[model samples]
Target: MTARKIIHIDMDAFYASVEQRDNPQLWGKPVIVAWRGNRSVVCAASYEARKFGVRSAMPAVRAGHLCPNAIFLPPDFPRYRAVSRQVREIFQHDTDLIEPLSLDEAYLDVTENKTGLPTATQVARTIREQIRS
Candidate 1:
């Protein structure tokens, strides 16, 4: 296989996941990361909220209307950045060719991974497991 080995890691609804991770009460519930205002747009929405049509970049007012029960919270960039850095560090263990798309997503070129993983899938899975731990 001559194709380059690349892995795209995206933390689904990272802001919402962080909220859920930090606050047990938010787990298994609709979480919307946005301010409470018509001008505000949703930064991220949990799967629970997505089921109700909530999404990133959607108007907060619409998000509220779509998921009235959703827990709306303001964006916390500093906290998310810290978490992102930790995630990036995990990627560093495998490869240094990381192209960060956002706080939660990155493109990793693991063609010649430092960890000696035979396949990109294994590298991705290992990074995921590290994040979980």
Candidate 2:
């Protein structure tokens, strides 16, 4: 039996990454994307924000305390959905065996890919570059 090669792609911090990608002002700065309320949960935190112990599912208030300089932005589901579709399309170009877990994460089976890539790592790198572009 032929072994199937699988590649997992997960954006470091999806919503936050999207925000940072779109807004040059947020680059290299801690970003927390979520609603702001007395009782609000964090949807995503950028890598810079994570450095301050911020994380998803944590309360917005706590996240602020963790990273006082963290830029708080509301989640933009529409933009995120658009980016998700783009990533899905890129994966489909390489293989039909694709499973999406969320906007930022997916699994691609590249054992027999359309791209004819020699290794799963190379496929993953290509996908990452595509997503970034």
lDDT of 1 by residue, 1-133 (tens): 7788999999999989999999998889999999999799999999999999898999999999999999999999999999999999999999999999999999999999999989999999999999988
Candidates in order have lDDT scores of: 0.95, 0.92
Q: What is the C-alpha lDDT profile of model 2 across 66-101, one tens digit per residue?
A: 999988999899999998898799999999999899
> Where in model 1 is the C-alpha error above 4 Å?
none
Mark the regions of model 2 whose C-alpha exceeds 4 Å error after superposition.
none
Consecutive 10-residue window with the lowest summed lDDT within model 1 = 1-10
Model 1 alpha-carbon miss at residue 16, Å? 0.6
lDDT score of residue 69 within candidate 1:
93
Error of 2 at 11 (Å): 1.3
Q: How accurate is candidate 2 locally (lDDT)?
A: 0.92
